[model samples]
Target: MRKKIQIVRHVVQLIFFILLVLVVVGTVCSFQIGGFQFTEPLGAIQVLMGGSIFFTPEKLYILLATSAILVTVTVLIGRAWCAWACPVMTFNEFIEYIMKRLRYKPVAERGKKKIELGEVRFATLAGVVAAAGISKTPAWCNVCPIGAICRTRSSGLLVAGAEMLILGVVFSANMYEKRFFCKYLCPVGGLLILLGKISSLIIPRASEKCTGCKACEYICPEGIPLFRNPDMSKCTKCLVCYSNCPYGAVKIDVI
Candidate 1:
């Protein structure tokens, strides 16, 4: 059985994000659709690239403030932003759930030989920054899924098509690699992962009670080896390990 706390927390997060989307994009919100200031971390990247081309000074200040808050929170709670907030993560989890229901032989299956894609996130982060600097515009903004989600439907076929293409690529890749986009591409998630390294939060293993069942290891979407400690930064704090441990051997602590 699934854990109630994580499920409830996730549902609440989804509801809050949907309401934000309703206000921002009317009926067109999604992973590549509607969003809010607190929903995505792209605005901060835009600010650091230069000033906001679209936001007024007041709004820019709010965006920066919220981004700081997000980073601070992540530093305190590990990468819980992905677990508890990100729309991309939320949708990916849904896609993963559906894939499971359909019994798709998920590529990230337990004991599978995993594709090792290290440093890609850092590279993409650098690429986005450089592209934005060279273009003197938020280069990725036009195609940012959160911005697209928050855009008006009148943007016509080009925007919609781009969003669909991006979504298709990411979702299709998910079939072969669970959360492939977040793991390998998303710059914002990369930033959060960087911040999470400084966070004291962690899912501690009660080695004494673990009994080597490996249930936690099997349930991890990130394929983290949770029998001991997971690959710290790779653990997104989903707490699936906590819930799946029949012996209740996984415990979270702020260290």
Candidate 2:
């Protein structure tokens, strides 16, 4: 079942990535289905923060309506966007695969001290919001890799070049760590983390049948200890532990 889930997730990621490219080419508007818009929640927040300096209520209502789907999805699935749908994650995986082929091990696999960047992520979120309000612009979006990809064909060469440079730097950082951007730097992911805390999504969790083997932690991309007091905030709902568990200790709580 876990194998099947992973397969489906990869397919979904690929589909979304393709749709994102289509969006870049002006083939589609927002992620819309059945006449409803699905947009990035962080984008809406940034717009609200930037425009609120002048008290833009019209934009507020429009943003709220557009962002509703994304916000609800985050609350239901705990960053499934990051793991299962985001084009950024798909591209990161490609980089990771190339790095592995070149024998560059990730920090987690190196037995080195992993730097905690959760605080940095939150600080970035605050900084970007502050910058947006003061500048009356969605400041971070200008440098955001996701935004970069979406605007690549639509924006000027210099603008797109700068955006891809930021994306390249972020992706290259993964040579030292798996998912460096998603784990530590994405303000969008930071916002989703808060929403994901209230997620009702049934995920692979350590059951009473678990031992103290710590196998799940060793395999977890985020290094969360499933049999221990794991930080669910960092969980991307990847379920790698569920598939790799030797004792079948990780099971989804259907209730």
Candidate 3:
């Protein structure tokens, strides 16, 4: 049963990765081949964050409605968006594949590792401190390659250089550690972690079946100990832990 679940999970992940790649390709091609201007809805989110009120009332209403929907989903399912929907997560998975193909192992092995929360906390704190000290928004978002990719795409640049640069960094980092971006950075991931604690659905451990073998921990990409706290904020509910556990100790349950 565990093997079957793992196979299914891998298949689903593969399909999702393919879909993400296609979306990016299709969007770029629409502009290049079809001569269609690609407008992303998330552009409004960025514009609003930038304090631009140029959008019509109708547009603002739409953006608010979309945000409400996203919040509802997050509230219901934790960071399901990070796990199953985000294009960036898809790209991160692809980078993992390439790293594996190159025989480059992540520095942090599953059971033997934990996400260095101290590092992440310090970095986030530093950002806040810098922002307050200098009265600036800090350089985090400016250097975010996702924003760069969107900007480049909006400007009609096919094969976005910024995206490539980010991919290069991810690949290089993966040669040393798995999910370097997810662990130490990624503001979207940070936000999800903060909100996931109150999520309706959470991953939990079946303590009765658990043997402390640490197989689930070894399989977890985010470096969480499934046995320690199944409701871990960083867990994406990817099911890798549940599928990989030989003892069938991990399961999804309502929190």
lDDT of candidate 3 over 42-126, digit per residue (tens) = 3333445444444577766655654555556666777666666555666677778787799866766534664555447346634
- Which residue pairs overlap in candidate 2's backbone? none
lDDT of 2 by residue, 138-193 (tens): 78877887777666666654567776788778877887788788767888878888
After aligning candidate 2 to the native by TM-score, how far in Å is the CA of 166 from where it should be? 1.4
Model 2 weakest lDDT span, ten residues long: 22-31
After superposition, the stretches of candidate 1 with alpha carbons farther than 4 Å from their true spots are: 24-40, 51-63, 108-114, 150-159, 201-204
Q: Relative to the true structure, how large is the alpha-carbon lDDT of every model?
A: 0.68, 0.75, 0.59
Question: lDDT-based ranking, best first?
Answer: 2, 1, 3
* TM-score per candidate: 0.79, 0.87, 0.71
Whole-model alpha-carbon lDDT for candidate 1: 0.68
Which lDDT tens digits does candidate 1 get at residues 1-255? 448967886796687557544434332222223334442455467555765434577766666665666777878887887777666777788888899899886676656788788769788777778888887676877666545544524455355776677777778988887778877887877777788887775655555677877777667766677776655776677787777788887777657
Model 2 residue 65 lDDT score: 80
Candidate 2: list runs displaced more than 4 Å: 23-34, 52-59, 155-159
